[model samples]
Target: MPSLTHMALVELEKAGILKFVISQNVNGLHLRSIYQGRLAELHGHSFMETCPSCGIEYFCDFEVETIGLKETSRRCSDEKCGARLRDTVFDWEDALPPKEMDPAEKHCKQADIVLCLGTRFQA
Candidate 1:
C-alpha cells in the first residue's frame, strides 16, 4: 500500500502544484497510488517489466521476480511481439537508464523549487 505521503503527492499533482516526480524508489508505490502525472523512476520500478523488442512497459500487480534487467516469465501482450519481459530494477553495477534519467535531468533544470523527501545524504 502507498503511504500517506504518496497519496499527498498524487493530490498535489492533480491540483497541478506538483509538476513532475523524480523518484529513486523502486517499490512502485507512486505508481500504485495512481499518480498519472509525469514520473521518472530513476532507479526503475519493482512492479514494472519492459519488452526489449517493442519497448512496451507492463506494470504488474505483484513485485517482479528479478532485478538487474533479467527476463521474467511473462511475454509481451502485443500479438506481433512476443518478446520476453525484463525487470526494470537496477543492480549496483547497472547504469542509469536513459529513458528515466533524461526527463529527470530536464525537470530538475526547469524547476524553481525541488522538494526532496525521505532521502539520505552521506558526507
Candidate 2:
C-alpha cells in the first residue's frame, strides 16, 4: 500500500539519512513501506494493538473493526495473559500516546534538518 514517495523515504531511512517518522496517517501505508521501525503513528494505526497487561504488540493483516481505543472483539493470545485487546485509534478528545510522543520529540530536537511530508497541522 506504500506509494512511490513512501518507498523512497524507506530507502532514506535505510541509508540513515532519515532518523525517524512521526505520522498522523492511520492508513498503515508507512508500515507496509519497508519501514524497519523508527516510526510513530500519532493518531494510532488501524492494524496494530498493544496489550496493556503483557505489553505485546499485535499487527493484523486486516483493518481492525473499531477505533477510538475501544475494546476489540479479539483478545491477546499469550498463554500467560489473555487480556482483551483495544483498538489503537484515538478519538477526537484522545491525547497522543506518550510512548510515541516522547521519542518523536527527542528525534525532532536532535535533527539538524527536518523534512516534513504530506501533512497538515493547525494552530
Candidate 3:
C-alpha cells in the first residue's frame, strides 16, 4: 500500500474498528511512512531485512530508489553475505509470525464485526 492506504488504516485503528493490519507485503511503506507499533506487517518490513541465520534485523537508513516496480527487489545491504532477501511477501511454505498472529486472533475474537474484503473462499 501507499501513504493513502496507510492513513486510512491509521484512521480505522483510531476508530477502534481495526486493531491491526496484517499485510502480505514487504514494501515497508506503512512502517516507514506511517505510525509504528500499531501495525503487524506479516511479510516483514522493507526498511530492515532480517537474517534467517543470526536472526538479526538490520536497519538501513540509506536511500534506496523507490522505482515502484519489479526492479525494486535487490540484495540485502549486508556486504558479507549479500543475500537477496525475498520480496514476494510471505512464501507459500512460510508460516505466520507469532507476533502478527496474536493481535489478529485477539481482534477476530473480540471484534463484533468481521469484515472480509475481496476474499475468495472455497467450500
Candidate 4:
C-alpha cells in the first residue's frame, strides 16, 4: 500500500468525503494504521490480538511473522504473552468481534454513497 494513498484516504475520511471503509482485506493497515474511524473489516485485521483464554480483544503494537503461512495469516511476536493475532474474521469455532462489526453496520446504514471497488462478493 502506498503511504500517499493512505494519507489521501485518511484526509478524505477526515473531511467527511468518505465515511466508511468496508474491506475484504485482513491487513489491518487501513483501519489500524490509517483510517481510525468508521471501518468494517469484512475479512478482519492483522493488528488485532485475541486472548484464547479470556477472549479479550485489543489493538496490538507488536510485530508479526507472515513468512511461511498463507498471505493472510499473522501471529504476534509475544510468545510469553501467548496472545495470537487474528487476521481473519476469526475461526468458525469463534465469534465475531463487536469492535469491528458494530461501527461497520452503523456506517452502512447511515452513509449516502456506497462505493464498491475491486470487490468480489462471495458472502
Stretches of model 2 off by over 4 angstroms after superposition: 34-36
Across residues 1-123, which tens digit of lDDT does each residue of candidate 1 receive? 888899888888778788888888999887776554488888898989999999998988899999999999999999999999999999989998898889889998999898888888442
State in Å the error of residue 39, model 4: 1.8
Tell me the deviation in Å of residue 83 in model 3. Answer: 12
lDDT digits (tens) for residues 86-122 of candidate 3: 3224554678778787877776677687655433633
TM-score of each: 0.88, 0.89, 0.55, 0.57
Error of 2 at 32 (Å): 1.9
Off by over 4 Å in 4: 3-7, 54-96
TM-score of 3: 0.55
Task: Score candidate 1 by TM-score against the native.
Answer: 0.88
Q: After superposition on all CA atoms, what RMSD does each candidate show versus the true structure?
A: 1.8, 1.6, 5.9, 5.5
- Ranking the candidates on TM-score from highest down gives 2, 1, 4, 3
Model 2 pairs in collision = none
User: Model 4: per-residue lDDT, tens digit, 53-114?
Assistant: 34555575653333111233434445565555443344444455577778877888898877
Candidate 3 displacement at residue 115 in angstroms: 3.7
User: Which candidate number would show the highest lDDT if scored against the true structure?
Assistant: 1
In candidate 2, position 107 carries an lDDT of 89
